[model samples]
Target: MTREEIYSEVVQILADSFELDAASIKLDSTLYEDLDLDSIDAVDIFVQLRDLTGRRPDPEVAKQIRTVDELVTFVENEIAAAERGDPEPQPQMPPGAGT
Candidate 1:
């Protein structure tokens, strides 16, 4: 998916998952400060992102994501990396199936 599409999906995830106002989300919005996300919320987002992109993000890299823009860029890079076969995409499992 394109960057714009990815941004839209991210916005939707935030709105749907956290009940935030979509209009309030901006590229510079800080996930914890502006969006009021906690660590658990961040994990939820990562799970949704994995489901969307079919790739898991490096935990260390995921920690550095602070804003919506950074999250989008990370996802874009993950998609590109998958396409390049640097790390093969993993099979997706249904949500809650393993947990």
Candidate 2:
């Protein structure tokens, strides 16, 4: 999907997950500070993105993500890379599977 489409979906996911107004989530909005999202919320966002994009973003890369725009861009790149077979499938345990 295009970046704009990915961004729109990301906004919807955030709004639905947090019950925040979609208008309140700007591209530059900091997920933690502006959105009041804790670490667990971040994980939930990642999980939702995984479901939406069918790709798992690297946790290391995710640590550097600070804004909604960044997340959208990351997903855009991930989806494109996955389509091109640039990303090897990584093992994933379902949430709480290891704990």
Candidate 3:
């Protein structure tokens, strides 16, 4: 998906999930400071993002995201990487990965 499309979809997700005005969800809007999203709201948003992108976002990378634009950029990069046949990197694990 294009970055524009990803941005639009993210806006819709945030708006619907938080019952906010889509018009107010600009690129610079900070999820917590601007939108008043708490940890639970953030989890909901990330769940929706995974559904939309078909990839689980790296939690470590996600921590660096503070604004709507950063979220969009992360998703866009994941999509682009998938399109290029590169799997999004998964979190490292020791032996007995699921144990």
Best by lDDT: 1
Error of 3 at 12 (Å): 0.3
Give candidate 1's root-mean-square deviation (CA, Å).
Answer: 5.0
Write one digit per residue (lDDT tens) for candidate 3, span 4-99: 999999999998889999999999999899999987787778788887677877778877788999999988887876677776657677878885
Candidate 2 Cα outliers beyond 4 Å, as residue runs? 92-99
lDDT of 1 by residue, 1-99 (tens): 999999999999999999999999999999999999999999999999986677877888899999999999988998888788776434577777765
How much is 88 displaced in model 3, in angstroms? 4.0
Instruction: Give each model's clash number.
Output: 0, 0, 0
Instruction: Please write out the lDDT profile of model 2 over residues 4-94, one tens digit for every residue.
Output: 8899999999999899999999999999999999999998888988876678778888889999888888898888877887864577668
TM-score, prediction 1: 0.86
Query: Model 3's lDDT to the true fold?
Result: 0.85
What lDDT does candidate 2 reach at residue 61? 88
The TM-scores of all predictions, comma-separated, are 0.86, 0.86, 0.82
Candidate 3 contains a number of clashing pairs equal to 0
